[model samples]
Structure formats: C-alpha cells, structure tokens
Target: MQEQSDNKQPLFYEIIGPAVLKERIPLYEVIGTLREYMNIIDRSYLTLTGKDRLSKKEREKYKIIAYEFNPGSLHIDLAIELYEIVQLVFPFMMPAGATGLWDLTKSSYNFVKTVAKLRAGGEDPVIQEDNSIQSYIIGDNNKIMVNPSISINSDKIEESVQKIGSFISPGAVEQVALKDMEEDGISITEEEKRLFNPETTISEDTETIVVKIYRLDIESKKGKLYILEGMEPKDIPFQIIGDQAIGPYIDALKADQLKVNILREMAASLTGKPYLKRVLLVGFPGIKPNQGKLF
Candidate 1:
C-alpha cells in the first residue's frame, strides 16, 4: 500500500486471474467493477450516518479518491477521509462518540465484511432491535454489527454485488478480492457469484392499497410510491409487473391526490418482513366509470 498523507489508510481491490498476468486489464471490466464497489461504499456510508441523502459539502468530504495502481494482478488503491462535520450531522440518534471519524472507518470496514459473508452463502443475518443487521465473518467468525434504518435498501447492495460478479470470467478473471492495506479481506470466486442473488419469495396473497405516486418512469415501468395510511409513511420503489398501460400512472401523477386501488405484489425476506416489489393498477376511486375506462 502506498503511504497516505492523512491518518486514513488506503484500501485495495485486486482482480486476480490469468487476464492480469500481463499487468494490464480491460477498461470496461475495471470501470464497471469499480462503479459497483463505489456504490457499496456509498450505501454503507448512508446507512452508518443515518442520512437519507448526502449534501454537496458532505459528498466532497466523504469522497473516495483512487490514487495509485500497483503491479501484480491489478490492484487499485483507494482512500477516503471523513471530516468532523460529517460525523456531527448525524440525523438519527447514535451512542455518544460513536459518530467519530474512526467509528465511521470501522463501520465501513464491517460493511465490506458483511457483504463478503452474504456472498459466501452464510446464514440469515441477525436483525437488530433497530432493524439493522449483524453478520459474522467467514474464517474467523468475527461479528460485525450494522445500525441501519427501516429502509436500509439491502436490495441495492445485492444488485451491486451481482453486477460486479457479472464481470468475472472463468479463465480470464477468476476472483476479486477487496482488502485493507494489511491484506486482510474477502475473496469472491467465480463459483460463489450466485450467492449474491436476492433471496425473495413472491407472495400468493395480494392487497389493495392507496398510494401517492412520487416519481414515475414510463419507459422503465418503474416508480416510487408514498403510502399514506401508516403512522410512519414510507416511500417504496415498485415495478409495473404486467403489460399495464402507462396512462393511469401518468394520470395519477397529474392528479396528485387521486386515490387508486393497486394490486400490490410483495417479496418476503428471511426475516419474514414483506417488502413492496411490483404493483398492478386495478381501479380508480372517485372517478366515473367512463372516465376511468378512458385510461
């Protein structure tokens, strides 16, 4: 690892296989894998900091810089330095001194270790009182605790890991290892790639609910909905399942407060919590039959 001017140590991600024997790597593969790696870090940071989104200043302070590339199977060195302001702005309540910069570093390291465990097809994660996760490392079985919100977005992390795995090839790129400066980390082999697939069971049961559409992408058939009935409202990401026309969703967006009955499809996790996945529009309330049929 290269010497860092700051107190923070540089992290390394090495792509191992015959492809890197020439001390060179493909542009697309490296770039794509790096992007997913960054996403994992960003998601972990958001969960640890308990913030919905990072501000412009916070983004600058928590930014990761890829400074040096080392020989021997293509290693990328990355570094991140957190400021005191970033720690002080924790919106959710955390234990005193838990929001320190070193605490953030430890959290980040634990996040990667947790991902590694999931990739290796470990047991179901232990859900904390705050709905966070507790994961154990593979070899040493070290416990890592993560304090996250109800909307932790574990699906995103799964998606990112799958994306990174997609770049792996049998003879060319066999394994990718994410390690610290001391060379302690997890290695993801090609055969273990399938472990990152999301374990979700589609429910046979369906429910009709009213939700306010916040964002919609007609081409992608995906949108975000805000459920209004609960004591603590939640914004859920959903995909249009069937060949449903986009007209009704567009109308709902324009109407803003229109109540609509949607057949919601949910995915149940190992924790037995049902999460919204897809929706099919069934009926529109307070609208004339002819008007509704027009959509």
Candidate 2:
C-alpha cells in the first residue's frame, strides 16, 4: 500500500497470525504471560510529509516496541520503520488474531528470487512485487497485514549460515542433512562445491577465523540478526525469531553446546580447574568442534 494524502488520523497497524489450533504459542506470549514491558516504546510523531525531516530532538523520543520471539510479528519491523514516515506505525484489528514481530527471512518471496504478490480474493488485481518497500503500509488507508506463518516455509537462511561457516572453514566441520538444502531457492556456495571434491585443499591451518557476522538485508539495506556460537546457547527462546525458527533453535542449541565444551577445553589449557580433569595442551591446528582432543 502506498502512502496517500487523505483526511484520516493515524492508526495502529495491526498484524494477524495464522489460524492454527492450541493458540499456536503466541510468539509474544510465553509459559503463561505476555511480555508487555518490552512491547511498548515511548511515542514518536511523524506525518506522511514530515517523515524525512525529523529533528534530532524529536527522534530522541521515538518509541521502540519490542515483541516476543514470534514470527507473526513481521509487521512490527515494518511498523517501526513506517513509524518514521507516519506518526502511527501500527493499525487496529479485530481480536482473535496473532500480532507482533515475526521473522520474514524464510518467507517464500525471500527465496532470493523475484516474487510477486497477487490478489488473494478479487476479480482482478495487478501483481505487486512482494518484498517491495514501495508497497509499505505507511500512510495507507486500507487494511494491511502479513502472515509470519507464510514466510516459515523456506530453509535457505540456515543453509546460508552453514555455507558461510563452510566458506570460512570448509571440510573442517560436519553438516546436517537439512531439508530442501538442494532446492531451487537455496544456493550452493563455491566452498560447498569444493567440499565435494576430495583433492581440494578445503582445510588449511590458520591463526584465526571470524566468529559471527554483521549482515545486512540486500533489498532493505537493513541490519539483521547474527547467530554465533557464544550467543545462541543463552538465547534459545529469542532465537525462535528466525528462518525455520524452531528447527534452527534446536540446531543452534546443539552448536552452542559444542562451543561451550570447546571453550571449556580452552579454559582448561589456560589454567587447570580444581575439580575437572585437566585438558592436555596439544598444539593441534584446524581442530573442528566435537572432533578434537577434548573427548
């Protein structure tokens, strides 16, 4: 929806979740409570015309709303961004639907391909680029909503993380046979191809390797979340807000466990712990996680 010059007041942009049984675990709700404290930010004001002219003093009061780790909250990100354009970033909605920020990384349109959105139920509608910021809900008069459930299909994000890791340390690590890794939307990096060739010097001893990344969304040019060994273990619930959220959480949990163990061995090498058995300092290069002398 494009921003329109109209005679209307700003409304809370509402987001709806999928129609699933068992309340579907509101990503914003946990064991039995809603995390409302982090959900609401202080109010900020902007209009369709004045979006680009926010003074430093005004932006200082911009409210940042944080939702639980829910994929249904995809609209929240846009809501926050759109808030900069219009005074209100959210919209009103009927009860009984899911709301909050959800991950859009695995959504069908996010397959690194040009995706078009068509009319769900209408006589005839012009196809719109699904991921276009031009269609953003800011200043639109019509109802706007997105299904985080819709974006949960693809597994490309996990593969990209794995591939990036592989690029950094080729055959030095093991891989899980994740579904749809070879699918059309997903890509195989050059490092992945080299892994298939036995003669390739995929592994080489190096002094250091980068741990995590600071990646940006290509289209939006927006900063996104980064998963590294250190953070995932401590953030199982929050990590649920990503590509294939549940599955990736489990995978990352496993990885973080190995990271913890490796860090343990490393800790021991520095100075032996009192009760724990000492890890013999073996000057091994290219030691992969779960496959080194820590065992």
Candidate 3:
C-alpha cells in the first residue's frame, strides 16, 4: 500500500446539496473529505507523513475520476457511482440515500488535467454555471443545475431519508454557529478539524469558467483493413459490403437526438451568467468523427 502522493487529474465537480446548493467542487473539498475518511479508516502519527496504507474498505470508499487524454476527444465515459462519489465530495452519513441526495449529488462537472488551470493567470472570463429555481434554495437564489443525478429516488439505494432529514436543520444551525466563531477566534478540536475544515475563497478572476463545445462535420473516406504478408487477418465482427459498409457495430451507433439537443441547450444557457467570469472551450470529447458519407 503506497501513499497517495498526488497524481495529475484536473476536474471541475458540481455537487447539488441539500437545500439546493449547486457548486463547483474545489480540490480542497476533495482533500478535506478524503482526509476525514482516511483518518477514520486508519491513521496514526505515521499517516500524516505519507506512509499510510489503504485498507480494502478504504479503497472502496473513494472513486478517482481523472481526465483521460483520448487522442481526439475530451469526454468522460459518464458512468457514475453515486455512493462512492458522495464520500469524496461530502463524506458524511448516508451518501446518496434519501438524505444523502440532499447531502451531495454530482452533475455535469467538467474534468480537467489540473486545478491550477482553473486558477490560470491573465484576464480570464468566469462562468456562474448556475440554473436558478425559486424557493428551492436561499429564498429564490438557488443557483444549481436542474434535477441532479444523485437526487433521483430508488429502492436500490441504501440510506434512510429519515436519518438525513433529522440532521439537516441541526447541521445548518451548527454551521452558522461555527461561522460566527471565525471572527471570535475559537479553537476547533482535532476531531472537528478534519470534518469542519473551512476552505478559503479563491480569486474572483477564477470564479466562473465557460466551456464551449463545437460540432464538426467529417467526410467518410475509403478505409481498408490491410493485413501483413506473413500474418492472418483477425475475424471481422461484421460482414464487409464493398468499401461502403464498415461494420455492424459502427452502424448500430446512431446519434442521440435528445441528448444532443440537451447538450446544446446547456452550452447556450451557460454562455452568459453573472457568476462565472471566464469561458473556454478546453475539450470537446462529444465531438466524434463520422464514418458514414454525408447524404
């Protein structure tokens, strides 16, 4: 079990929380929560020095979502595990359970190679990245994404809404109380320190970021599956009908119209918002090369 020494994975995480708070998750939030979960699983003084080993339970508790440099695409596979994700974003009781949905839900967060890029220099524009709903959060100031993935209810989930509901009011009061201590200079115990660590706000320049996706038109060219002189050709998955038909697998993939429209609407909505100060079309993984000739 080697120590987690920081691999490079840039990510922008949005967690829709209870009482309707949709926010881009910072790296510190991930670190702070992971620190709490790690300490709970195993931690002595040696743990602080980066010599700690993760146990089986600890490994299952966190999911590492790193950005992959797929040659021509900047896209996530988009299969999300709700529970494990919550522990990283909000390592509290009943992650993704009824109360957990309110605790944290990951929705449409951008993945990058590094967080420092989000903190880039120069007159960078910011994107608020918010969709507001009335009376949902902060007296009509709720600026979060639409119904989050974690918010969907299911019998398959393993948490009691009752338990989470019980904690919300008390938790809010406690947070407000602790916030007051910032001015008074109160000391937090070691136990409270991990779970209650406050993240300092970053510069306003980095507050908002915009990502623009472009649609591309590709020309289908004649592709040949050439084999070596001494080698045998592997069995093809589909029958080749002249140079026109590629394979059944290729034919099986049809453009998802609903999803395409939804994505376009999302990009358009984020184009101008009060919160985000910058916008960049960093990667567009959804853009794929068309194998079929234009009709």
lDDT of each: 0.55, 0.24, 0.22
Query: Using Cα atoms with residue i matched to residue i, what is each candidate's TM-score against the true structure?
Result: 0.54, 0.17, 0.17
Looking at model 2, how many pairs of residues clash?
A: 11
Clashes of each: 0, 11, 20
- Candidate 1 lDDT over residue span 6-27, tens digit each: 4354677888888876547776
What's model 3's TM-score? 0.17
Task: Give lDDT for model 2.
Answer: 0.24
Q: Over the stretch 1-295, how does candidate 2's per-residue lDDT look in tens digits?
A: 2121221111122222232124353333221111221121110122122242446665543433333222432222212222332333322231110111111221322321211111111111112223333222312332333332222222123323323324222332222111111231122234332322112111122222112222222221222122244322211101111122133223332342222111211112112221111111111235333324222
Which has the greatest lDDT? 1
lDDT score at residue 63, model 3, on the 0-100 scale: 41
Question: Over 4 Å off in model 2, which ranges?
Answer: 1-22, 26-78, 81-202, 207-295
Which ten-residue region of model 3 has the weakest summed lDDT?
260-269
Question: Which runs in model 1 stand beyond 4 Å of their true positions?
Answer: 2-7, 88-146, 149-156, 198-295
Instruction: Estimate the lDDT of model 3.
Output: 0.22
Cα lDDT of model 3 by residue, 1-295, tens digit: 1122222112221212232222332334334433332232122111211333545664464443433322211111211122242222222232322222222221111111011122222112222222232111212232222222221211011112112212223222121101011122111223222212212222212111121111111112111111122123221011112233333223323422111100100111112321211121111135332334212
The 10-residue segment of model 2 with minimum total lDDT is 233-242
